[model samples]
Target chain A: MPLPRRLVLTAALAFPALARARDTIPPEARPVPARLLPVPGTVSPELQRLIAAPYPVGWNVTPTDAAGWRQVQVASSAAIEPHMAALAASLRVRVEPSSIAGVPVFIVTPETLPAANRDRLLLHLHGGGYVLYPGLVGVGEAMLMASHGGFSCVSVDYRMPPDHPFPAALNDAIAVWRALTAERDPRRMAIFGSSAGGGLTLATLLRARQDDLPFPAAIAPGTPWCDLTDAGDSLRANAYVDNVLVAPTGWLGGAARLYAAERDLADPLISPIFGDFTGFPPAILTSGTRDLLLSDTVRAHRKLRRAGVTAALQVFEGQSHAQFISPGVPETAEAFGEIAGFLGRHLA
Target chain B: MPLPRRLVLTAALAFPALARARDTIPPEARPVPARLLPVPGTVSPELQRLIAAPYPVGWNVTPTDAAGWRQVQVASSAAIEPHMAALAASLRVRVEPSSIAGVPVFIVTPETLPAANRDRLLLHLHGGGYVLYPGLVGVGEAMLMASHGGFSCVSVDYRMPPDHPFPAALNDAIAVWRALTAERDPRRMAIFGSSAGGGLTLATLLRARQDDLPFPAAIAPGTPWCDLTDAGDSLRANAYVDNVLVAPTGWLGGAARLYAAERDLADPLISPIFGDFTGFPPAILTSGTRDLLLSDTVRAHRKLRRAGVTAALQVFEGQSHAQFISPGVPETAEAFGEIAGFLGRHLA
Candidate 1:
């Protein structure tokens, strides 16, 4: 056949695929590379919507004092409690408030035990940038564990920054653990959490070992903020690219500073990544590619491997900063399901 | 009540939580961080086994010269065709050889006719650093589109280095498009590929525009080898952390050099990221944090948007080069399905 003519369709439609004809497409026609677009025909319409769902921009207005921080916590808790209740109810779990050694806690228990592992327990810590969520919003991870792992769960209502700060949350966790261990077999239990809760989970283990408390059967720290110091590579490499936690120097940095106050950030309790991890119980870690803590999680996994601990990491695609919390997202179920499955095999 | 001991069992657990004897747990007993552990009592005995499943390490003994590269291609093609055949049968797609304008291609068509839109086509380019994965091995990406997207697919079995380097692949794609566009509506067609295929898919769009051909409706370039010059950040940031394509300075770099021959890598046809995306069709990009070309893919998406193209990005966690191609991965299905969905809406 004779060579087909060039420039026919491009010239006809004036499609801007031509760089040499830069003037063809106007500047305003260009849109910001929005994080995720709801493109049709690629995935199911429902998934397209889900993938394109925007994360609430969590811009922290640094609270100057305890009262201001308390106000922030109250407002956040009120908005999230209802959602947590709905999630728990859907998972067929009951939420009841109680006190352990005078510290308030939320108890999450399945309505009916599976007749086999009724005595097993999981302690959960919720993630909210260390100062955001309190009370019920802090129980999402606990609810998942109780609902899916066939174990009763409890979450500590830990004191947070701008008020109690560093040692407070850690102390609260220690107290609750001390109370639980009074009767519960540590070997039959597991502790897990996400975000700040994830960091707290690692710190709790360190403190527990320091106090000579028995180790839990296993732990799942979902994208643990192990290095509160922002020493991870992704902190710079993924800045702005990770729409969530856009910059560690902003809210994430603020939260870390507020929590640490006069304390050393490198303190193992604050940044567990620097802590001693040998002989630690088997651990499972989870995180997303866009999560600013991607390096933190990966580094933690690497450290765990170095320490010869049995660790399993389950990372989901297109996720950011605990995107697993959305009950509607399949990745959420996949993450929690994997955690439950890992816990099932590891828990005493 | 009396000041209770620090270690007490929860009334529910009835097991002891101990503290106070800090000396019992020696400091030396605790090591550094750990990795995925088989935590007892967490998951079923079976799932723990599944979660711990090891990836078959893909070790490539890359050939040094043109003839060696050709031999490697034959060996790899022979090894992978049976697997691809099994996958095609499962997807109910018939894969057979066809020629368009003297270019050899693989036609992958769904067995059943959908009531609507059966005339639409997806042109797939397969990936293998430029000189590898010839013949059926190059058709993996095409298979995914045909199976999941319900589209009649055709993969360009483009020429590679050692025999037909550089513009051979791009030219072959252009020739095929020219022939196909003679009979088919350009807007009814879409193109995609991964790695080298991803790069070629992009170059095809650039060259097609240069030839002034009508634009395809959409394209999905998965973890594209956009910058053949190794300019992207992840190439360094990810380094050995990415087990696949471990170091670009090694085989990946070698392949790029061979493919380009004497051409400038900055040439839009070689590294399409440098191309002006002014009027390109709406596009979707996919990659993972662990993929060394992650920056390449991300940067390309950014450029397309800056050039005024409608583009979407989906990043996976803990994945390597085109890790989404695993036949058993739900993420693979999810990724391909989304691409098909996007094309469906954009295609005529």
Candidate 2:
């Protein structure tokens, strides 16, 4: 009746069939699926592509000067607002346009909220390997995060790789931060992101420190791609077990090369694990055991702690990378709840 | 019917009486009842005195001599085996004596277990604040970890602090590890500890790296005091909120100083957060949000990650430090389950 026992019984029954199937397929070809992966009914095609990509290579390869890159970035940005508008309508949150460092930004606040009911502002960067899935694609996830976490969220559509490259995304994040400091109190702020966005979150903090900018009260980098080099053992060891990513050589590693094109891979600005983390704020990082970037999250967490930064790392079992975006999953919801509690403790 | 909701309602009803009792006691005079402390029933007289004393003043306080430290360590070692023996008796596991680097070690193996069964081993260190509660006091916990994890646990009765200070505990752990390398394979091994033992877990890895020893598959540092300087903000911020360890200044801080004695507090062996973590294994660090050393766990996790180490951190809500010893508590059981699950994944 229970899951594990049921699984055991079912596995016993299917052992012979599984063995036959294994014999028919070559080990090297076993990991690749033959059919078109079905998108969850609730997810958009754009998001599906973003999530389904072997690695976020497309984002890194879009040429900065190319017309196609410009069109894709524009299309991506345009695609996001409609999704967010739908989410805002459902959640009853007031979504307003604002400028941070002259860049257009959207501030989503709970409607009719009073000063006593003030919540922390989360500056979020959406994950798409820095090339795709702008703020719009994250509307559902953002709404879920805000409602569950009881915070206002501002999702940024930073410049993507290929065109903008290493510092472009980092620069945009800092500009928006400076704008927030000019208009809002830094004490009421936290930063969060997943995948490439997660890496960007850490990069932003490092940039803020170097530029003498105010740090957010807390940060959450979920399955961050902190090391562009993909030198961690998991990148090799977990290559097949993790179903989401294609493989480091084919996807993530390629994306890294494109993102870091002419930049140094060890530049702390590009790979925050190498940054001087002297004055960063408190942070919480989440990852899964099967994630290729699990090592990156661990490395970043240790670096921050060594620098006297308050930080926590949470790793979920039996999960793939950035599974947090799939809010319908039990693990995703629990992970969000943990983030909410961590933020409440620090931000309160 | 649901337990959490019922408990919340019950707590709400009892709030007024609790407030009244709090008002009757002065803030400084408020004493946490013994029942709320970890392993309250087992607090020895010497441990009480050590915990109650104000910070030792001036240098050359004639710290515990080598013989005195060894005597206390041995006594504490003897104290823990009874509980372990009781657990092994209940689980029908065979307890055997073994020597590791001339130090006596206890191994708990499940009875009638097949040779083909997974060969998982937990190398556990006991908590004592580096001063008290050595090997003997931790048998119950060690046994529980071993049983629940479905593995043979080799618990080391490593030397304590004061007389044995700094590298002494670290060295002893490495020696046990060396002995283990000859006895077992590294692929299915894990290291775990609590409090001072937790610190030793991290310290051991540092020593192992410097000495070119094989790394364990995974590690669990439960409420580890990773920072010898006691400089984490939580020491001051959560001082009163934390029910265990009456005062950080006299309790943990003083204990750390006395344990390290004349050794440099910043030495990587003394404070693992300062170590180069390039060659270490994956780790899982646990703590309660209310624990004074919660920040230490967080910081240590971050440092390990930044050095490209795979690490996971889990913080239990509403828990005191090292609550893992209290297996009756649901949170404790859940924490152990998580540790076991993590170990299973990495070790399998």
Candidate 3:
């Protein structure tokens, strides 16, 4: 069961998360602030409330093995079930289970789609650190975007670990993308997602570029997990400052390992930040001052811009990871508005 | 010598540095690390050396009054004189003292200016928290840009505080801008600066927009102090973390008061972030992860983009305020290269 010497070195390089120093930890060891801080009055009351909330107790929970991951996934699906009906009803978005190229997806349609966006379709990749939020649970963000952006969506319920890992989710995403782009005019389509979904979105484009497939009109990868390895500064600087992903060594790192499996984490599809962004579509990235992936999102935007692609980035005042997905918040509305507007400009 | 009630209220609003909470202070209260951290190996050795250096001993030194500020100015000039000669010599840039429309300026020309940039000129405004670097001392950055960017620069030696405050600096910048634009095609010109100089650059554009004058083709405002008021989140979030401007209540706030005099800090002419960015030229902004003015730079970029202007923003990893200006650093080269490329794209 022992790994070969070369494999060990590659594994070491792949999971540098273990080798990362605790330098991001504030030398003065004070407890993380429990209050809305740095700048409180500047943000909305709703955001203030959201910012003050502590990290979920089990945020860093790690499953012992494949079976444990399945249990966590099932539990997550169940927990998210109750909110599904309510969110769909309030947002006036209908989520229909569907399949594209044999890949499971949730076709999210706004009750009142704008005539302007009638021909527009957004490919959605739902976020859950590549392990959680499978099935209908992953459709929440897609639903929100559909409702707010007034565009129909195909939310990929991509395969995840415990059952299928590494190329499974990306394969599902590519399959859906390939199927959709085949029938639809790629100019009228865009790919969008948050966190892992965001990572998948970029990976999809990188694959499309590699396959010489026509690129989507645009992309919105919100606080993407662009780099799987512990390569970014914010991973440390925003460590405990980001309440959502409290630290890099927590569940996120474990999820990354579970997802990558035996593959090298630096593989472009695994960590798209290492991928070349040349000839990629215009992108609008979102993160927050307090987001753990702020560095990932900004770095990706910089890379894209450096590649001569127009990339717009918006960092919310006090938001943590994917806090813009919180419904009824002004910041959420603004974030979605920016994304929708940016996508609209590029899409036919 | 008691101030009037109205003045006191305005002063309170103008200088909220005292009222700011210490929420950004890491709860653990660990001493700031002396080593390069968070992501040590990510940056160049030059940047690592620069970032690890502690804040200048008198970075927060507050002059008691007009005479004290004058004394500080003289000291700053003397100290900077040595670097001026060395930098100019090394950069292969010729700095000539000149006057534009009665305003003192430094015409920084490269030893070998590229033929393509013969007609292109960059109007530079030097950064010194609006109270330091005066006369020829303010032209070092201009020299770097001239040599590295292959563009001639006219660095405005704008009037400063104690004797000439508030409108005087803005007036000098505007006067020079008007005089230059009157002769040169506005399309061939760009305005660029860092920190307080950046604030002035934005204010000048806002003024031009107000007066129905033409705007420069492009701008590069590096880590601008866009808001004179304590309105930004980074002012608190990056407090002691930004070694350059360690805290909001230091000499920065004092300088703000000295610059504004009796003016409201929220005035668009003072805090240009408060100004409308409609019809502005393309802009490129730069900042650092650890910059106190990071929020300022990002906020300005957002505002400009929101106003339908083409704005590109580049934030360096693990850097403090204006560290991009450090000569012989890869980051410095990268930052200037981005600005130069962006400006070239916009300029004739």
Candidate 4:
């Protein structure tokens, strides 16, 4: 079945949720020729290779329930489990399984912490479209930040659906945040993540405001899935052009539905793009030309700036949905560098 | 002939300037299927209709010389000329032919100017790939701004290539800006345009700085063709996806070549993306998800922000190059509204 238009106006509309008419799509939506793309010379050789590479394994799986999601999660976790030790050793970071406020987490500490960031701490949220990555497999981004940005990190292992949906993940995030803020100075802390993790980063802030919690010094939300209602221009414009998340209809659409469950997709908690960003701390957003969530990140940046918060946005040459985090791509290093630089300037 | 890779590293390198190997194109480039695109529900009915409409007349023309370009320019100018009076009358703006510093211009004034902007003025530069819109026909955007933004505007009818090239347009822009500042406060002035006009807006600022002139309070450079070298990622990534400009191999590449003539493409004056943006005034940029110049506009906003200048970027849903300027589209009004609001806050 084709992906249905998800932005329903009301509950009583009885819109055809599963029906997609042939003439409904925009006529301008046509195939893009690869040769017509920016030549290989535009981006670094490493990114060029990655851009030309095939999509990651199992990018199109549409798991139905918790059992099915767990099965896919285990396979993905095991695939990265072997490389975790080597990756940590190379970065000279120590990763220990831990828990914060009873929420499972990973404590990542660099071997030689720079004096400048000694009092600073980063709360990391791993992104897997709110599902895929679990346990140690999700600590890669945290490890990268610890190693490259010279900061101690806590990687949030938030709960996901089809068992724990909506507020469960948000609940775990706020719980950890509350615990961290109670112990550490909010002025010396920051939060960062990519994709679903990025979405949670913003939602956490919205929740923090409601709880009257002091906000962190800054944030880095890279290509956030902040609008889960699938209401951004790139959701349609970048469909197949974005090789990684080739189309919203694939796994992503299923994941959003599975995760949101019965909750309103436009609820600010589920989609932070709809949340008020007033008085939010300085933010640095990252995305690529071909990312499926480019519009989400751009909208979040605009919202932050509109609310009078200082915000910076960096868009890499030609990347698709978190491709900046690809193993050793130069774009990955640059993306992290820009985020770290922004956070460093804001953190006390 | 196909658009050659325009970003040549050096003049002495004996590269195959005219040859393009079929294998050189990325294998991923294939014809996009319209059915897989975002459904028609994403944008306004007016914009959807425009998006669904066929490309504008003469969109694919590639004139060879001065005479050829002149013929094309006349046809385009004549086509738009018939509507100028009606558009101005409906917009409630008076258009008067005038000259500043001996350079031809169209002075646009809203009949009911808001008291706040009585002394403020906007310098307009119209876009036509640097060779299309000329004379009174180029004042459409100025009229829109005068009527909608409630500000007096001076639309620079700058000279274009095939007759005048390189610094001629930039020269005229700076001359008018200097003349305007001589009599009025620079703090109350803003400059704007789309496409080539957008490019000229940035270039004008760079030139003004060199002449040790006071800067305007703000600027709106929408979908600027800021990089004549064709160095941006969108020039390739948005190739066929951008319906209006289709591909870099089209008339745009030819126009860039004709305008730049013998100058270095990467010279900061020619490509403001390479210019320093330090101390630049607040700027609000506009582009669409599918604009061929989206990357250029994105890059300029980053540059301005990095230099500590406030910048806002609005990427409309499903817009192509300058489609935000399409008459009667809600997106166009929104795009102009964002720019006008941003400028209003900054201007004295």
TM-score for each candidate, following the candidate numbering = 0.51, 0.46, 0.85, 0.81
lDDT (tens digit, per residue) of candidate 3 on B1-348: 221121111000111111112224323312222222443455776666555554444556676788767766676565456556767888899889999999999999999988889999999998887888787777867877887799999999999998888999999999999999999999999999989889999999989887777899999998888898887777766665665677786778889999999999899999999999888889989887767787798788878877888887787777777877876777777778878988999998
How should the candidates be ordered by TM-score, best one leading?
A: 3, 4, 1, 2
In model 2, the number of clashes is 16
**Residue A341 deviation, candidate 4, in Å?**
5.0
Between 3 and 4, whose TM-score is larger?
Answer: 3
lDDT of 2 at A182: 80
Tens-place lDDT digits, model 2, residues B1-348: 111111110010101111122233322211111111121111233222222222112111222355544544354344343444554666566766677898766776666544433576788876766766544344455766755556678877666665566667777789999888777888779898877778889888888877778889999988787777756544543443343543364445656776788878988888887777786788888875445676577667756765667777876533445644553344445567678777777884
Better of 1 and 4 by DockQ: 4
Model 1 TM-score, all chains together: 0.51
CA shift at A121, candidate 1, in angstroms? 0.6
- Alpha-carbon RMSD of each model: 19.4, 23.1, 11.8, 10.0
lDDT of 1 at B138: 71
Clashing pairs in 4: A29-B34, A30-B32, A31-B31, A31-B32, A31-B33, A32-B32, A33-B29, A34-B29, A38-B236
DockQ for every prediction shown: 0.03, 0.02, 0.09, 0.15
Instruction: Give model 2's TM-score versus the native structure.
Output: 0.46
lDDT of each: 0.67, 0.59, 0.77, 0.76
Query: How high is the TM-score of chain B in model 2?
Result: 0.74
